[model samples]
Target: MIATVVGVGLIGGSLAISLKEKGVANWIIGVDHSQENLAKAQELKIIDEGSTLEDALQRSQLIILAIPVDAMLKALPSILDKIQPHHVIMDVGSTKEKLLQLVAGHPKRGRFVAAHPMAGTEYSGPEAAVRNLFVQKTMVLCDVKNSDEDALELIESMVDKLNMRLVYMNAEEHDLHTAYVSHISHITSFALALTVLEKEKEQGRIFELASGGFESTVRLAKSSPDMWVPIFKHNRSNVLDVLDEHIHQLQQMRELLAQEDYDTFYKLIQKSNKIRKILK
Candidate 1:
């Protein structure tokens, strides 16, 4: 089937590459507003052809929107006008609630499949595409019971090619869980990076003292502020709720240390260590 990927950045380019490499799509078309990205996507051989917004919808059986969260607010509405009954539209944006709300009453809503592939790297643009990106990932499909049978089948088939599991959730549930698991991780990474940079002040000292733990914790700080700013803004309530909890926990640790509550601090660390088994 012909697949058209919008934005053609890290997620879109990687998806196009995966589809082409796995023989998942009969043809892969790419659409990006940035000419530089379009060129990079083409140079990387991520798509079989470059497509227009209208052209991609008319010609493609599957369309993937892998753009920024804010851009999706405007883009998804336009898709409602162009999508055919046979076409399937899936967005890989981090947050879903607002965008889903925008299209909730659309005539072609059933043709659009809201999906979030639980995979990414702290990079952007077409050049950041990687062959191993989607392997062994969990792809959450939100409110898919409303999607057309054929449209849903196409998405399921493509996720299968990536060896990713398909998970079903509503828009609310997806955003809430992702806030706790995925979004919070990014915020923590950003804060940790800022904290270290503030403390070290010297870039040389930062590089000299950096270890595996620092690298692991600060990795997501490399993610684009352009992309994340809107995400945090749009999901403000949930993000702030989680951030408050995180800050409270941090304060509690500091208080324990100040009071010399060694036993309580040890128990807290032990409880946090339980995640090792769960994450493993």
Candidate 2:
């Protein structure tokens, strides 16, 4: 397959590498607004060539948009406007609802497939790309019924080549669930990192005493705001709902601690530990 990945950042670069390594794409043409990123991707052999969006679209059969959610909303319609019936367009953005709605009524809607690969690291750019990043990960296809059967099957086959598990969901359900599982975690991590930074200003010994648990909990805070801010913006209401409940839980724990209610706090901790059953 001739593939073109727009953005050439972490997700796009990683996809380019995996597709080449697994023989999924015979050639990869990269498209990015950043010249430096395009250069880096080419230097790393992540993409065979770099071209403008219009030129790349004309040359490729499979077109993947791995840009931020906001950019995807703007670019999807235009790309769909230009694609021929034989071209298949797919997006690997974090959120789905808005992008799906933006192109819902386009005449070429069936040529597009909405996908979210539930895999990534707290990193960005071409240098952060890695091979086999999608292996054993879940690829959620939202609103598949809106896509042509051949388009859907092409993506499913690509997902299978990447060794990922496939699941389906409507855009609304995917947005709500991801807000709870994915979005909230990043917000909590950012908050935790800020809290620790505030303490570090008063005491330089803060990070010196940090441990793995602290590192792991705050790791998502290192993620790029350029990528996450748009996500929070697009999924505003859902994120706000989750944040409210999170704050309430923290308030409950604080009140328990203030009152010296060790018994109830112990039960709360025990109850939270039940997450192991679901995660494991």
- lDDT per residue as tens, model 2, 44-105: 99999999988988889999999999989989998898999999999999899999888889
Which stretches of candidate 2 lie above 4 Å from their native place? 202-204
Against the reference, the lDDT scores of all candidates come to 0.89, 0.94
| Candidate 2, number of clashes | 0
In candidate 1, what residue range of length 10 has the lowest lDDT sum? 79-88
- Pairs with steric clashes in candidate 1: none
Q: For candidate 2, report its TM-score.
A: 0.98
Residue-level error in angstroms, candidate 2, position 92: 0.5
User: Lowest lDDT 10-mer window, candidate 2?
Assistant: 199-208
Clashes of 1: 0
Could you say which candidate leads in TM-score? 2
TM-score of each: 0.97, 0.98
Best by lDDT: 2
